[model samples]
Target chain A: MVSVVPSLWGYAIAGYVMTAGAIGLYVVALHARARRARDRAAAIAGRRRTSTPP
Target chain B: MVSSLERVAGRITAPRGERILGWATLVAMAASAVMSLVVSPPDAQQGNAARLLYIHVPSAWLAYLSFAVVFVASIAYLATRRTRWDRLAAASAEVGVLFTALAIALGSLWGKPVWGTWWTWDPRITTTTILLLIYVGYLAVRRLSDSPARRARWAAVVGVVGFLDVPVSYLSVTWWRGLHQGTTIRLLGESTIAPIMQVALMTGVFAFTLLFLYLVTVRLRLGRLEDRAVAEALSPRLGQSAEALLEQEASARG
Candidate 1:
């Protein structure tokens, strides 16, 4: 059997890398944004409690 | 009152089984990568460059699938006027755009080596790009309104109409003369590719589908939380308690 062109390997590798990288980054961003929103909500609730007279 | 808040909070939290789905997606994707790169043999004509099909076809499938979800969910939201359907539609659109962008980029990458050009005005490429822009507009529609019902209504319209482009994109290669190849794989008929390549391609499709499901689930949960946060932020200005604010928002959404 004839061997595949060596240069084609780079293209294949790059395609996979880009696909995986995009997905991984998106997942990380989602988690980070969720954490930030949760913290913001907590802070807002805290301020509401502290500003109110006990 | 406490129960109502708890219920809202629970709805915003990650859906059950999301964690397991996430891990399964990761494993499946890894296997798919291995199968595509290591297991599958090179084509006689395209050589190893054909391996790009594993990622390219799957990303395209996902982009198409995501938009179909958005289309169906959008119709349901318009009919029922439910926030959940709206959220699902929005979440699906977001995921669909992500995959669409990936598909375009991967196609460009493949084009550079095979077609000897980084870009082209081929019917398939043009139509797919149009599909991407339409959903990008859908996301913009979501940001255009503060009122939940108005936002859902407007976005649902875009989501439904924007879906017309999907069929156009799928058929462009057939409908018009193009540099892109026509459909090689058929659901009702046999595929023209080798068995090993077909297996690798199928694995890629399964893996990406799982990933799409997991991401949409996370996005839906996050969307609800963000909506709640915005409602809560506006509560003080409206002179309403959090519970009352949520109730009003829920009713308004209905």
Candidate 2:
């Protein structure tokens, strides 16, 4: 029985790295966009409250 | 454990446990990486190149799952005119495209090493490419319209029509001879994959699914916030609150 030696490790590593990196970047982008949107919503709400006299 | 999880879920605000899900997804993805790259053995034929399967297969699964969510959500959106459903469809479409693109890239990477080419116009590959293009067009149609209701309607229609590609892509390998292989895991019976490879691949699927859920949730919340902000901006009344503007918009549309 012949053993199958590992080959194309570079391609495997590159593929995995690209997958992980892409996912990571997307996650980060989501968080950043969420935060910015939250701030904008708060600002909108705050401006409305300030303009409306109690 | 169930009770604790429920309590945590109840405590989280709109988008519900965004932090918890995000962290869980990260942990699951890390575990999957370890299992796939370190614990799994080389393939009998493809050697180390087979490791790409762990990521590629899972991504393809997620792409399908995400589009399925889009399809269901789009139908719900069209039927109900509810913002939540529209947001769900939009977020799912975005994430679905991302995963689909990743699957194509990983498949290309695997093909380059094993098939001695970066790409081929295989039936499965061509169908999957069409799938990606369809969703991208869905996203573009979403951006083309300014009115929320109009945009949602158009995108929903696209989502429903675009979903026809999913089954086509999935069955392409078997329906026609292609460079890609047929399904290894099936619903009716046991899988044909090696035990060790099966474990890693399943882990990848689980992790990628978690990540997809987290991403879509976050994207939905962002969409909601943006919608609210835009509503406020569009309101006729000076300094109108988002809630008030939303009411005004709804009434105007009605």
DockQ of each: 0.62, 0.67
Residues B1-254 of candidate 1 have per-residue lDDT tens digits of 63685465355344557787888998999999899989998777677778889999999999999999999889987786767778889988989999999999989988988899999999999999999999999999999987877888899999999999999999998899988999888888888888888899999999999999889878877776676667656675534544455445646766
The residue-by-residue lDDT of candidate 2 on B5-94, one tens digit each, is 536534542454878888899899999999998999888789899999999999999999999999998997777676667788999999
Alpha-carbon shift of residue B233 in model 2 (angstroms): 1.4
lDDT of 1 at B16: 56
Best by DockQ: 2
| Residue B105 Cα positional deviation in candidate 1, in Å, after optimal superposition | 0.8
Top-TM-score structure, candidate number: 2
Off by over 4 Å in 1: A1-6, A52-54, B1-16, B236-254
Q: lDDT of model 2 at residue B1?
A: 64
